[model samples]
Target: MDGLLLRTNYSDITEFILVGFSRRPHVQAAFFSGLLCLYLVTFLGNSLIVIVIQRDPQLHTPMYFFLSNLSFLDICYSTSWEPYVLTQCFKNFPTISYTRCYALMTTSLFLGMTECLLLAVMAYDRFVAISNPLRYTVIMNNQVCLQMAVGTWVSAFFISIVPIVAIPANFCGHNIINHFTCEIQAMLKLVCSDTSMSLILGLVISTFTLPLPFTFILISYIRIVAAVLRIRSTEARLKAFSTCGSHLTVVTIFYGTAIYMYVKPQSKESQDQDKVISIFYGAVTPMLNPLIYTLRNKDVKGALRKLIGGKEKS
Candidate 1:
């Protein structure tokens, strides 16, 4: 049995090649082009958010602070995925070593988890604004917002370390990850050893990382909705709901895709399907965020008008 097991091992299997859909040269070329464009747009959109938020002191509220961080994270998130795939177009086989794999996985997990925390924080900001407009500034002051932001990154930092320490113990088999990036699910599937520990770690982290944050967001919005309903003024309630409505929509898409990817067991039928969902959370979500936020936001539009009007006046 030992000899049989050894027989299956090939010297060339040291690197796990990505079987990214469609080996056809045309399909691959199209994929590379498309991903490159998305990558560029992702950076530009997020960078503009950061720049505009920082430059426009009037927009220096908790909302824009969170938006700037979100944009920065989106930029980093895309970097964690796109650079590897795009490099493949130029190189014969864009290979990542074990050390690189571990690093990439850690970065992706860190940013992904951090975004989970940040989104929850943003939801709370919206919740506070709609529910208690009288005390918005005092409630979401610079010091308070700073703590929230710092706490988010720190939580993700320490939380990510747990997985990094855990993953190295598993005996890597075939060392190939199927997706564009070194995702946790992709890494776990290739391990030769028992996955019980990885699963347990995933469960533990996911509790802090997902459901609780989701629960908080849910509770906040539930209260928010209730408060909005009580307001006899139709115009005020409608205006409040409009802002919260956009946030709710964006949250549902972001969390819905994320929950689909990570919450369920990836059965054989769902594995390829999961890949598409991963693209939704990992790629599509970032691109959509700035568009959704800026276009939907009345303040941002007003600011843009002021910016353009000032330019025209000059």
Candidate 2:
């Protein structure tokens, strides 16, 4: 059959050409500079949060524990691709080895999925804290928090790998990827075989990763808001809102862009749009997370100040 012949003759793609931003020198230069700066900020900000939380005994609570994990995830997530993307800016035709491409894709997917579940867990933490202040410690004990964290990472890995495993090795023969990184949807566009199964599998996995966790977050917030409203004191209500506002902002920025990117139909016309949106959740949100939490949180800020004072006194 002709199909058999086509399959037999298929070229084993050794590498993939990443067609990143505009080929213009000016555009590449600007984007490289902007992305480099963003990466640095993201690294430093998240790193600082982790270090501060680890050193501060006051911050050993369930909330900061989750935040530290989030920071670590952001560091790993961005590092998986940003350096490659930066180097590609200098090349006329940027290429990634086939094995490395898949590795990066799998890593990013696992981390992204972990973050989604982690965020939902964090929302649940907030709900427990605000709704049952007295029982919060008992409910979210060290063992429970550790189990949740472990479960999030483990579940995300399984979820991330399933769709990847489903994709036939020879599904894509094309060597050119039109996006910056080895994003699944972008790679899907290059498939030489029928993509219906791949797309369906991706949709099912994405539902569990994105929408399901997102819905849990929304429900958790609804309950949190209801609990806060029942508080009689204006000061208590303001305090509750203040504690949650940063997490809510982060969830919105991350999940909003993510939902848009993954949940929507991927089209040829939307590749550029996809890149732009990816930059938000991928780079911008990570950089902003530390700033948002620190600026809004008195406890984190106080701990930061105390750390600085201790260093200065030494």
**Which candidate leads the pack in TM-score?**
2
lDDT of 1: 0.72
How do all models score by TM-score?
Answer: 0.87, 0.93
Off by over 4 Å in 2: 1-11, 169-172, 268-270, 310-314
Task: Kindly list the per-residue Cα lDDT of model 1 for residues 122-223, writing each as its tens digit.
Answer: 889988887788999999999999999999999898887756564534433566566656676766666565556666667777777777888899999999
Task: Assess candidate 2 and give its lDDT.
Answer: 0.82
What TM-score does candidate 2 reach? 0.93
Which residue pairs of candidate 2 clash?
A: none
Query: For candidate 2, what's the RMSD?
Result: 4.5
Q: Write the per-residue lDDT of candidate 2 for residues 192-257, one digit (tens) a residue.
A: 676666667777777887888889999999999999999999998998999899999999999999
Score candidate 1 by TM-score against the native.
0.87
Say which candidate scores most in lDDT: 2
Question: Please, what is the whole-model Cα lDDT of each candidate in the order they appear?
Answer: 0.72, 0.82
Q: What's the CA error at residue 94 for candidate 1, in Å? A: 3.9
